[model samples]
Target: MNNISWRGIRAFLYVAEHGGFTAAAEVSGFSKANLSQLVTELEAALSVQLLYRTTRQLRLTEIGQGYYERCKIAMQQLDSAAEWASQSTDELRGEIRMNAVGGPVGEEVLAPLIIEFQRQHPGIRVDLDFSSIHVDLIASHYDLVMRMGELPDSTLIARRLHSVTTRYVASPEFVAENHEIAGPDDLKSLPLIRGSVDTWTLSKGKTRKTVHVAEGIKVTSGRVMRQAALAGLGVTRLADVYVQADLQQGRLTEVLPAWSEETQLTLVCPPLRHQLHRVRVLMEWLKAHFAERYQQALAEGPGQHFKSNLGAS
Candidate 1:
């Protein structure tokens, strides 16, 4: 309607997307009452009952669903037009929305990199969302997404930033107290701290096998798994990027090195055409960062057991 405001449209879209006024208010920076008022104003202007509300939940009416679909298209077009206009300038400015899996990757790797990127480009604003659930990049308006493990075929433009080798590691004390673990088969008897997965697939050249570990402690966080290993709770398999320092320091000793699995860490964008200059700069920075880290890892060499520490063990 001619009487409808962009604020009202945004409020309605956000509420509908988030499924409630309270959640929408959190993201839109509006008070819940204010958001409710905006939505009411929008409904009054459109002359339709858009939402069916209860004390506990909010549901969209049939007309509301149709309206939401049309509004989403219009909003996407407006966003594209704004992005296009902004791209005319060579100056790095505008917002970039990035999504990544939460935990070690988010806390240890991306958080610092994002802080550094913001410091370098004062004109650019970055929104980093760390969640285990994968969001639809195009529909959610995300500029980029970082993912790990095997990537299925997708229309999204995928770039392999780096491949991190997974290492089965445990504390040197734990390894010393327990009998020597000669190979993957020995892992069956050892206490294992499981993280996110119950099984690990190990490969040696063409030969590959999956070992279902006997779990001692189950954790969702990689950092927690490392901490558990440091405490000598059990063995764990984690990406080298996450445990490089621990390995180098001999806080954790690598077990079954020959069976380590390499998983590719990838960055995916909706499409090259949709990416802005700011997004491109961040992507390049990320690529360079990973490359440098990989080179450093190579230079550092595989983690070694200190002779003095081994003697004490």
Candidate 2:
């Protein structure tokens, strides 16, 4: 308590949240023995039991639980104070842990912007986490997530970065074989390429329909799906950004323009009434970065997905 170490506090906090020393160490970056030692010091200083550790379990002592609550509040306040001071300056600096879809923009557009931002402020650390899954901002502890479309929970702040269109596409060969197709109904007849992994709901207001679009070649990644569609395996739907290059070069055709859908490119933030300045800063950075990428995201997509599958039957 007197010779309080921030490292010890962080480790202790992670341990309290995760319910174990090993987990705390993994998250906060400390060896398990080191974390245990820190906790021992903390407990000795506070003169109170902080945790009850069993062979396979960890539980907070009554005093430890109270201490955790107070510590969490204190940590939030300190984080907020630091974030506010950083934001008040023109320079956006600090470690930003972000979640994003690991696509071309993340590599090409956002990454470069992040580099520039870091160069502008040498003190900041940018940790970008690319994941296909929707990241929980509070629980997973990401500063921001550059996401597409609407947020499930209304409480979240889904800041619109830009809007993008989704189009049904297929290779020239597939189009040649199914040239008779005219509309969304035609999708039922064309060889489809979606995994049964998720329920895709497509609608034009009152005519909402949840399409169970799993058939033909199944794939998990949108990049892979686009590749399959480009290889003439089947007609698949994709965001305009994914197939932009193909659409321009005629490697892929926008088969169902009538069924095309548009959604905003967004950065989702925590639902809290007042989020930390760091999260807010990242959100602003994303909006600015996307403004530059929007033109490309709208006009063209990434290079053709690993093309060798062109001969795919």
Candidate 3:
């Protein structure tokens, strides 16, 4: 036999099942003449007379009956396979590997949200890595990464989850002892707990200013910087999200609030085309969850310090 034609096989099956060329053509969208031609071609390919044709009617041969039965099963299986492949894309059933910083943003904010997300979507398994060191997403095959501050120009797609405003804060005891922090210039005189960056960028309305303060205690981690600030180890600029609770409880006092800098918290990932269904779902869930948490954090009292310009980009 020559190479089989699926088109001819489909036409033959339709004709045999529908009992006539006219009826089969109506259902299959093939013309009556085309249907007849396809059946003739199929018979020629098989080298057997599969149908008995006359002016009034048509009937399938015994061999044709057996062939139709087998073809029907094969076609049904093909349809099932196609359906399964399509459903795999729509259904959430995979693993998502993500990287984040090991601070309040990761442990206090994202970790709980991820746990809740996994509870909601039981099929998705999330692997979250927390470290201060940056990881190469493409090289490590990470599904996504959460980063703070200004994102450098790159091919990675960044979704701004929230805008983080930094406030220069100190313990109430420290502030009471060193009460010379009345303006931006006084920050230079006070003992400052410097993090990775030594310079502070502050903006008000249309005016922006940068101040280089003396570093009293140098730390690499934001959490440690915050802890140092909380322990009355001089003043430091920290994100409002990380210190909202402490500020509310009178543990820390906001100093020079008018000169705070606003940076962005972004979720960086590969392009949308490369993202799996579970990854997409998690991104959207994070956006919504973070937005709500951002609002709640602002609403929990000591409202004078925290700003509310939270939005997605």
Q: Give the Cα error of residue 235 in candidate 3, in Å.
A: 1.0
Name the weakest run of 10 consecutive residues (lDDT summed) in model 1: 300-309
In candidate 3, what are the lDDT values of residues 39-74, reduced to their tens digit? 898889888888999999999999998888788767
Q: How do the residues 82-193 of candidate 2 rate in per-residue lDDT, one tens digit apiece?
A: 6655564554456677777676656655666777777866777878877688676654556667887677777668888777787878888888876567656666656788
Candidate of highest lDDT: 1
Candidate 1: list runs displaced more than 4 Å.
Answer: 1-15, 18-58, 61-74, 102-104, 293-313
lDDT of 1 by residue, 1-313 (tens): 5899899999999999999998998898999999899999999999999999999889999999999988986788687767777585678888888888665556545666788899999998999988778676656677888888776748877888877788999999999999988887788888899977889777899987777977588898777888899999988988786677788877889988888887788988766424677887888888878666454543443322223335789
Among all candidates shown, the one with the greatest TM-score? 1
lDDT comparison, 1 vs 3, better candidate: 1
Q: Against the true structure, what is each candidate's TM-score?
A: 0.72, 0.71, 0.61
Instruction: Provide the global lDDT of candidate 3 against the true structure.
Output: 0.78
Error of 2 at 6 (Å): 12
TM-score winner, 1 or 2: 1
Model 1 steric clash total: 0
